[model samples]
Target chain A: MTVSDIQKLLNAKVLSCNEKLNMEVTNAFASDMMSDCLAFAKDANVLITGLCNPQVMRTAELLDIECIIFIKGKEPTDSMITLAQNNGICVLMSEYCMFETAGILFKTGEIGGATVGC
Target chain B: MAADNTIKLHYDVPNDDFTRAGEASSDLKGKLKQMGISPDAIRKVSIALYEGEINMVIHANGGYIDAEISENGLKLVLCDTGPGINDIVQATQAGFSTALEQTRMLGFGAGMGLPNMLQNTDDMIIDSIVGVGTTITMFIKM
Candidate 1:
């Protein structure tokens, strides 16, 4: 699925790198733990998290994570947005909770990275 | 400065600024990119280095990383002199952490730092003395 689809599915706001909304994403992983994503995330996967911080962006850069969706209405800070912009990672904020966000995306074939192979 | 075929570098990590934890790893990533290193090697090294940097910041008060890059391989030594670990075995296990509550709130202290470093590097070694310091050496061959 493309990044734009995720934005529309969760009614998320694109905080940065809107130009890459058309970029395709294969799967996603939802967690508040940054280390989990660091270990399991592959390039171009969507990283969904409730923890909003700059370290999250730093992890995204290391793993080449294509998109990040902050669920439960958690918005990223100004510094986080700057990090995302500099790294060319798409940042989005969803009003839905983690379960709802992951469920909707799962129903649409954007399954979890853990459930499937990376 | 003394070697023609190797690039040796050092980075000082300060614990006073948690937000600045990944600077050294990020700088190394950029330098590796400029050197045209394989994407796979770059990914593995960057992830391992970043985790080490974060560990130093969160647990050791502060430390420094000395790196040597060449055709042979990449070697990194991270040293910190703050409350050395008494049990290296437990510390290396996943899901084992001694971080403060505030550190976890910032999305760290999952106890995955050492494990991540182990997973990404081909060779790893850890040395520590209680009340003295901790040093970690890792190598990834190209």
Candidate 2:
């Protein structure tokens, strides 16, 4: 799936990197804990999180995640937007809560956990 | 152990500043990407070093990071003067953390930092003194 698809599905607003909305993302991981996200988020291109700290952007940079979807109307600060822009990551904010967002994406088959062996 | 081809970078981590914890790692990631390093290698180095950087800020008050990059691999050494880990074995275990409750609220201190570091690197070594400090050396192969 793509960032555009996620935006349409969740009715999310593009906070940064709007030009890259068409970018393709294969998988996603939803978590508030940066540690857990860092440990198990292999090959996941989208991060669904409620944490608004700069570390979220840092984690996305480290993992090469393409987009960050902040749930429950959580907005990212200017620094976070600047960081995401510098890293070429798209930031989206959704009014839905974390659980509902994850469920919607999963039901649409646009996002899911890490896939095991081929 | 300095080689002619090595590119070394250094940074000093500040205490209790969760907002700025990953600056060093972010800088290193950009440098590696500019050098045309493989994405896989860069990802490994980024995750491993970033985790170590966060650990330094969370556990060790603050610290220093020295990263040496060569054609073959990247070597990252993080040294801190904070309270040292009391148990290396337990510390390496997943879900075992000593971080304050406040730290956890910021979406960290889940006890996966060390394990995540080890998982992303080719080699790792930890040395610590109870009251002196802790130093972690991690190598990510290119």
Candidate 3:
């Protein structure tokens, strides 16, 4: 699925990366813990997190996460958005809670293909 | 590459600024890539050492990180002067963590930091003095 597809599926708002919505996301991981994501995530994947902080983006940079979905109606701060944009990682915001966001993405075939925990 | 060795990088970690936590690891990643180390080796070192570095800054009030790269493997040493671990066994447990509530709120402190480091690195050794400091050494063979 693409970033645009994720936004349309979850009815999320493109808080950032308005121009890069067409980027394809092969898989996704939803977690509030940056360490788990860093420890497990493999290759390019979308990170669906409820945590709002610059460190989230930092984690994404290290793991090369392609996109970030902020669940629970949370919006990233300006610094977070700026960092994401600078790193070329798409940032999306949605009103749905974490479970719902992961459910939609998973059901839509953006499965966990990141080879995590292997 | 040095004599029977290769490249070495050392960084001083500052504990006060949480914002600067991953800078050193990020730099090392870039350097490793430029040196043409295997992606697998670099990834293991990056994840393991990054977690250790974060732990030092957050829990140990800052220290130093040294990474020596050779044809055989990568050696990482992390030393910190903060509240040392009283129970090394419990601290090694996967779900044990002493991070503050605020740190957890920032998406850390799940107690997986040390375990994650252990899991990622090929070998790891930790030394600590309760009222003094702690030193952790890790290696990932190429």
- Between candidates 2 and 3, which one is better according to lDDT? 2
| Higher-scoring candidate on TM-score, 1 or 2 | 2
Ranking by DockQ: 2, 1, 3
Q: Alpha carbon lDDT of residue A14, candidate 1?
A: 95
Estimate the TM-score of every prediction: 0.94, 0.94, 0.91
For candidate 3, what TM-score does chain B get against the true chain B? 0.94
Model 1 residue A115 lDDT? 28
Q: What TM-score does structure 2 among the candidates reach?
A: 0.94
Candidate 3: docking tier: medium
Q: For model 1, how many clashes?
A: 0
Badly placed stretches (over 4 Å) of model 3 are: A42-44, A113-118, B1-5
Ranking by lDDT: 2, 1, 3
TM-score of chain A of 3: 0.92
- For model 2, which pairs clash? none
Q: A1-118 in candidate 3: lDDT tens per residue?
A: 7789888999998887788899877877778898888766776478999998888888887777878999988888898798888878889899999989988887866565564654
Instruction: Encode model 2's per-residue lDDT on A22-114: one tens digit a residue.
Output: 888888889999888887888889899999899999999888888999999999989889999998999999999999998999898756675
TM-score of 3: 0.91
